[model samples]
Target: MIRKLEGRTWKFGDNINTDLMIPSFALAEPEEKQPKYCFSANRPGWVDLVKPGDILVAGNNFGTGSSRPGAKVLKSLGIICLLAESINGLFLRNCVNYGLPALPCPGVFSSFNEGDIASVQLEEGKVVNLNSGRVLATTALPNMLLEILAAGGIVPLLEGKGLLDKAR
Candidate 1:
């Protein structure tokens, strides 16, 4: 898996649910077009400002809502990884399934301001603020999850092992 990620941070508050990331209306749009609508309701014009390799830092209960493929949209929008004070369990799985690394660091919300550079080491469960030289410990992902991420998600992992039919 990708062991490390360093990127500019995008700070968000608590309860950043699936609806905010990918509105119900956006889901009906083409997959490639859906990302443009991310955070459109709450952070108008924010999606346009996001750059590839950016990291999202959020407060508690991040991604707490319906299973609407929000994680896929975030990855498509170029967010390489997510650091949050807390992440909803279902959403966390979705993130992994979509090949987006997400970690929960208890104090992550206050660690950086928007635009600060942050570095994350997934397996090590470490987060560092490159701008401030502050380090935070995160909940490490499991080895199996890391393997799935390395293969670009569970489907690919299974396919590689010949456990899934490619035709399907």
Candidate 2:
């Protein structure tokens, strides 16, 4: 994973949960077909608007529901990373596990609007709004977690070390 990421923003509000991201009904679909149903419950046509390398900027309690592999679906939708006022613990872990860089950035939600550009420096824990020239500090991920993300999540890291059977 690149330590620095820059992309267009897609703003969402507080308490945006896992169900809103990938509804239970969509779970039955094949993985490749699942991205189309993302945000179907609320933002009905949101999936169609997302472009590859877009960044999701959301308000507090982002990803506040079940452990439903929501990060994977977001990544599939071409979201490069997530920047939120706060992120749920389990969801943060899931993002790392799925190779998505999610930062808990205080004041981020107010700094950028939809379609604004955001630049994130992961290692430095800094978020800058390119459009408005605003900058916010984020809670940085530890180096160990960064390594996991860089290696494309824990499973791949272990596989590369021959610690687990790759065929599985």
User: What would the per-residue lDDT of candidate 1 be over residues 86-136, giving only the tens digit for each residue?
Assistant: 999999999999989999899988889899999999999999999999999
- Model 1, stretches more than 4 Å misplaced? none
lDDT of each: 0.90, 0.91
Tell me how candidate 2 scores on lDDT.
Answer: 0.91
Q: Give the TM-scores of the predictions, in the order they appear.
A: 0.95, 0.95
Candidate 2, superposed: residue stretches over 4 Å from native: none
Model 1 / residue 17 / CA error / Å: 0.7
